[model samples]
Target: MYKCFLEIGFEAELSTHEDPELLELAHEMCNEDVATRHIACAELRDMIYERGECNPYRMDDVFLLRFLRARDFIVPKAHRLLVRWCNFRIQYPYLYEGVDLWALVKIKDAYEGTLLDRPDIGRLSIFRFGTWDTSEFPVEDLVKAGVLMFDIGIRQPKLQVLGGTLIVDLEGITLRHVATLTPTIAYQIVSLLGVTTPARLKSCHIINYSWILNTFFYLFKRFIPREFYDKIFFHGYDLKSLQKHIDLECLPPRYGGTCNSHAPFGLWLQKIKKYRTAEFDKEMKALGYLVKE
Candidate 1:
């Protein structure tokens, strides 16, 4: 058990309520066979390095384990998924390079949300999305902001191990906002969340969805894969229904939760900004990549 934790360099203590299936899977993949694990990790690393996907920053055992678990320990499938992730980062340098407080604030304002400190019962990180001023920024900026958040998320062992939960608050959304959901932007968002990113999506709750929003969502669904449709829950102004999936206590006051006197957007932003800024710089330096200022 300790060996498994050490192999992954997991500094955070495991949650008491961690899923048994995930724990069992981690143990089976990392702890069960030391020699076999090393051989397999070596093979995967060689494959990734040979393709120049991860050169200076090689994939370690713990990192490779994430790909393996994502693909149910299938080497070929995991390799393909891992390659996709690498390609996504390379293709979208703006999202990952030279991240700082200024960039984060812009992203936060563009998307109008933050990741809450407290997770759901399943230990998934909770992202609370507020009303976005769609007129303020381009659609691609919003997508880049979302991708940056996922980059921050995957750095955390707990979130990567368990997954993520999204709560989209559509209280102030207007027809203008809905109109921005073009097929091209919708495909980018769906593919980024579903295929490219390393974080697993546990659930997505869309609260306060208006009738007009439903039509937009219907059109938006066409871009996403059929399987992801099951993960999305549309709760139109039903706090009780939303609470069924996410505990009310974990939510902000605006969402009928008692966690804070008001929306804790500032708190979440400070936490993410403080923790991720330096790490993002280091990652860019490691990859010998830089973002154009």
Candidate 2:
């Protein structure tokens, strides 16, 4: 059926809910897979109960709301997906604990793609999200959520970018790389940050960036719309750095904004502790091909 939908362009939007990510959440209420179905639906329910503020970009809140018009706009699969996982937990309620959530993330060198949709450090800008005090605990689940960076054109996975190049840092050139130590590094850092996890990543988004204003604006003295850019298409880059990049739309961005503003570091463990859930899963099954540096 899904294959058929592909030919017909049957598109289904995902709500901000976390359950859909489980993949099994798509299983129908009547489908019979026993363990698979039970785990999928049950776990889906659990994720919802544990749900806090769903990322507006990832999942939609409206999907949970049944009948926006009282009779129309029913989202059963959504409702089921969002909360079924929780149903699995009624027997034993537990929260992720004792895992160091603040795992140091090393962005791997991108062999072929681009990175997009990563942490929103702008909000976390020391001013807004507040700085972390090791004495306090937070940001564990967020650590678990990892990141969603766009891989514009690169293809190879898992090569850590050693450091920014002379052009990328000084001239402000954008380079792509894979995260060298997602699972392995997570092992070390999570132990330090103190949060539990299968240590799996949340998701990955792919997009592009451009440096526009740096090329123009001073002459026009007038403003250009940022939407006017020519290269980047996917949304969510740092409003600060993205200004440097002009999407094909040619719109001008705020002077200080660009996608580079995306958070570079992990949140403090103190923040992750608040909504921690243990039943989610623990024990990182370490396995891999580490490109020896």
TM-scores of all candidate predictions against the true structure: 0.71, 0.22
Model 2 lDDT tens row, 1-293: 74454222111111122233222322221132324433444443445456642221122222222111111112344443223222322211222222232332321121111122211210111111112232243333323323211110000111110000000111222221111223433342222110121111211121222443233223222221232223112323443343333331222122232322222323221222222233111211011111111
Candidate 1 vs. true structure, TM-score = 0.71
How well is each residue in 1-293 modelled by candidate 1, as lDDT tens digits? 74553323222322223355546545543242434756767777777767765432447776676666555556766677788777766766665565442344554433433233333432333333334666666766677656655554455545555555666666666777777777766766776654665556667778775677766677667876677778889889988898788776666666676543221333444544343345455654565434323
**Number of residue pairs clashing in candidate 1, backbone atoms closer than 3 angstroms, sequence gap of 3 or more or interchain:** 0
What are the root-mean-square deviations of the candidates from the true structure over C-alphas? 7.0, 19.6
Worst 10-residue lDDT window for candidate 2 reads 158-167
| Model 2 alpha-carbon miss at residue 173, Å | 12
Error of 2 at 34 (Å): 36
Question: lDDT of all predictions, in order shown?
Answer: 0.57, 0.23
